[model samples]
Target: GDDMAILAALGLQSYRFSIEWARIEPEDGVFSQAALDHYQRCIDACLSRGLAPVLTYHHFTLPLWLARQGGMTSPEFPDRFARFCEHATRHLRGFDIACTINELNLPLFIREPLMARMTSEKALARIAAAEAVLHGSINSFFLYSPREVILNQGLAAHAKGRDAIKSVRSEIQVGVTFAVQDEQAEPGAEALRDQRREDFYGVCLDAVKGDDFIGVQTYSRVVSKRDGSSGPEEGHPRTVMGYEDRPQALAATCRFVWERTATPIIVTENGWAGDDDRRRAAFVPEALSELHDAIAEGVDVRGYFYWSLLDNYEWAAGYGPKFGLIGVDRATQQRRIKPSAVLLGDIARANALGADNRSAAAPQVMGDGAPVGL
Candidate 1:
């Protein structure tokens, strides 16, 4: 239903969208030719209009086969996933820009939704009661709340993402990408250190430990530490949902990665979710400023892509979080550019003029922690 004409109108040169696995391959190895044809048309349409297609092979969802076959936990997952990547990359060869994986961290939750899904009747009763409080208005941001808690068993997710990259490296200009909420450990709190917030983050980066490029997805920041305290306790003051106005922290994180890795980095996803145009505009500039500082300080930062071409389904949050430059009416799929989207268009134009030219340097933080063997 999406012609993506709004993006062309907004003057965006490149945009990233995922090839929904479920849509393409509803069954195991039984892909729909119609889906392939539709996708081909989509790709050709983008190229025809001078828009770069950064095709994502997988987002959070997967073919029911994979989910049925033990999902990522299956021993056969690596081989099957690699084969899938090989086929996808070969099929979409010569796309303008390319991404191998979507939000890598997100798969962590999708593979295990039960961690958050409440089964008790009492809980269901409470949810019904809570909805009654809204007086028929949908709590659009429901999934983002703590109740929908999906834990990332960091190492497992990282391994899957890494496997995806290695699978297609020989066939495509592939990169590893993940959605990251810039979580910070609360300063002066030993518990923050104990909770291993940094460890969890490091795992995401580790997924692409030795890749051609790394895609960093920035949405909000959440300072998550295991809260064992009784009530209303604060350990490390990480950003509330990963957006704590901490440009310095963002810069430091990038700098840390720069100091360590040899891979070129891309800001694959960075945006604010709000109704305020001014704040949203400020958000992009600030994140870019931090990125600029990281590059200047010797990070091989390559390109920056905003979180979306347009606001669509916010996953469990539905249509609530407006992380798009072109706002979407979920009901109508009509698109209009927010001021921030305009700012991005200007930046994209400038960058296209400049091209992706950068220098190479050895990482400064390459081995802060001893390397782990995969």
Candidate 2:
């Protein structure tokens, strides 16, 4: 209730939040009406404030019961997810946009089994402790690799979930979001970069080609070298996540995805992880300027929802990183709106960037005819 009020106060007309699968269904076939009712109240609250609700059906966490049964690797996973979607969508009245899954490509990059096998016992113990604190009662320890299993199962689940939603209420626009990085090739390593991009994100993009839209969740650019190293260029201004503060990365990423899928795009998540609100304030307009350039060049971008509205708990990093427009006092539960929140709110109200916030010049055209700049 307070969160919706804060969003309305920020002049935000749309809100994007996730619904945890574990909360909706604790057991295989058991559906919780109480959970559905709770989400309905949340939707109603958003509508009351003239805010359009964008709901993501699944985030990262899975019910402990389901996880024990092999989770995404289980043959029954996709169908079970579809059944849940059908039940949940029946209670949702005004949600226009829905995402079937959040960051389906994440598993390919962060292989938990491989990490656990490689890291020392001490480090693994620390990680286990952290997971315990982060997930509370949920036992999130997985001994096997669901990486390849999920890539295939996730697509099936997305398709089934989309069908399930449409079966119940045909008007909801459904798609899946991917964690995209603007990847560039070092001189003479173009093929390596292409292969890496395909390995990481190509399958997901190909799967969503026929969906209503594709959510581009980009934060930084990665350069692939001939020697197989990849990361942000040396000495660039870095975010708290150690990502390069390259606002122009968004434009290039949008273009790359649009060219391949030809699907309409919506920036699902884009924000910096830092304590400096001034840097965040500056980053927003600059990144928006690059997004504007992409739109000007004819990319069908539907909307931009900032990564977050408040400083909430991040998965592994916990609550240490501040990526919110409004700061939270954990002890007192107080909300303090930062200057960046006001700046973003004003931009939202205006529906366009102010003249001063525009990019300094036209993007520089690369050798391959791609325009790159902020």
Candidate 3:
């Protein structure tokens, strides 16, 4: 397939892609061998091209049947997910690395009611409209209460899923991913920022402590003040997602997660979202340079997978945010590789950072260079 060929051309040694639960099991207690066979072809294609496939069992989409049954908050959710993982792993046995879930902490922040309450009226209206278009009705969104329930269920699902996969193939590596925001505090807000980090990520990071590795997905920097104000600063360059253009966030996030969990890290998702290929071209080298600095400093960082290989649908945002190294025409399904893809490909082929691409100044050190105690 074109995807495998392109990955091989770029000299990438690994490819990470997700399997849709809905596609594989459209109804409760029903399984489709055709879907399994289809994904098998994808796995075989990657192998033929000499690329190791890193498969993710879930990536934020629930089968309508599962959603109707209370999704993640359901007590049965973990067992159901583990059953699905057990089925999927039978087909994916040879692959050495598998992610049990993507962004386990995402549900806490993205629930409809929370967004409706926390965001501007205009932003809330846009989200409601997008939900209608994506799900056919705004009322269809899952609304779970007591945020702790969502976190607890996610942790349970991840633990069960990891165990299920390891049961099938004991040698396989299994872990869950987290979305880490590199939060900086204003002079009077250090404790507040620390508390926010604990509230958002601490539990999930603790859950994955004994797993194979943790997937750190970070893209920008957020500055928090004691008054609970937090967002990109006004003057910084922003990505299409409205995140500040802080390439060094990669290093800061790596160090932060390393200090907390002491688990091996894999950057499962990191990239800028924009239509300007030129900006992406420039952004990648800078981000990778920061990543290289993290590696040189004794963080057991394993690999980095760009956020995406193609511009595709982005949940409620739809196709508006472009985070791909390749562009696609929705009408004709045509593909065009962007300049940034080539830039990244060159770096992969060389297997070393280019001298010209080094950061002009020393990269920022995370956490005052102090030993972090969990």
Candidate 4:
């Protein structure tokens, strides 16, 4: 496919995409020179095309070594993941931009039924056994939601990761991306739900507060609670996921976050998924419009990177949800540019041109603004 060419065609200034950890480091502790070179080439290509590469150190993918180490939830995991982050940043020090972690707030652990069942059962048994062996030890406590554990561990690792990157290349700009959902305030529910959303910001803010940028992945509204009397609503607006579809609420949440944090924000992944292109485009425009409003209201919103350049495996759902601007033919890996892709390309071109013109016309400065020729 024309992955690199497509980026150039889009005239993109900045593009955010994840490098599957498994793809890069398939075997534990073993570095693949070929893969490393390939990524180096990819980064070079982005720079060649004038597109800043926003590298995601970890998405949902994990290395086998880390996976065997009980993934992110393992107590030993924070150190292990820190080492991995140190290693990754060491290798990717010269990238255009770095997002140390992606979607750290997503409820990926409990959402996947099979994995959740296995994780809960396995973790409980392990914790129970540990508690028995270390009955008096203070570190014997157990917690559910390995993903949550991962968040705690990953944030620490992210800090180490940042230091590691700067040690090698001090010029690289690094940050973190959180999957933030805007929640709607329920009727008669007071503003408690709003507080919960604000608390969610703590997770993101805590992770990237010291970083150069904040990548916020926003999608449908976050439903705080569903009315139980809705009579078995499975699909449509009344569905459980409907509470997460509040666009205005999401915008407000963004505004709140921007007000609280001085860091520049980037909409790393904010787009809709639909069966057809038209619906997808409509949703994207709406989201972008909300983002624009947020920016206009002084949100310090910087760049926008659509969730995905292409559809990939969505964990348990695999390839079920098509959220890509470019439709991927899974069988052959061929990509078809959807209408949203075209629209994004146009938007990028316009923004880049606008930025260029603004810069070119700005008056030159000389020695504390004194006359240059005098």
Name the best candidate (by TM-score).
2
**Over 4 Å off in model 1, which ranges?**
1-3, 106-119, 122-171, 194-198, 223-249, 352-374
Lowest lDDT sum, 10 consecutive residues, model 2, at 365-374
State how far residue 343 of model 4 sits from its true place (Å): 1.2
* TM-score attained by model 2: 0.89
- Which stretches of candidate 4 lie above 4 Å from their native place? 23-28, 108-151, 225-250, 352-374
* Tens-digit lDDT string for candidate 2 (1-374): 78777777767677788877888897878878888888888889888987778888888878776766667777888998999899899877878889898887787766754476648888677767755654542222233455567678888999999999999988888988888899998899899899878988888898889799998888899988878888888887898888999888888888989999999987888888799999989988888888888888878777777777888688777998888888889999998988988887777766667866443332221000000111
The runs of at least 3 residues in candidate 3 whose Cα sits more than 4 Å from the true structure, single-residue gaps closed, are: 112-114, 117-142, 356-374
Alpha carbon RMSD to native, model 4: 9.2
User: How well does model 2 score by local distance difference test?
Assistant: 0.77
Tens digits of per-residue lDDT, candidate 3, 1-374, equal 67768767766667788888998988987888899888888888878887777888998888877766666766888999999999988875447888998888876656754656547888668767756554643332234346777777888999999999989998998889988989899889898789878888888888789789998888899888767788887798999888998988988999999989999988888888999999988887788787778777877787778877888788868999998888889998898978887777677666666766443322221100000000
All candidates: TM-score: 0.72, 0.89, 0.88, 0.76
Query: Candidate 3, 255: how far from true, in Å?
Result: 0.3
The per-model lDDT (C-alpha) reads 0.54, 0.77, 0.77, 0.58
**lDDT tens digits, residues 62-104, model 1?**
5666655545555565566666665565555446445665665
Higher-TM-score candidate of 1 and 2: 2
Clashes of each: 11, 0, 0, 8
Task: Rate residue 319 of model 1 by lDDT.
Answer: 73
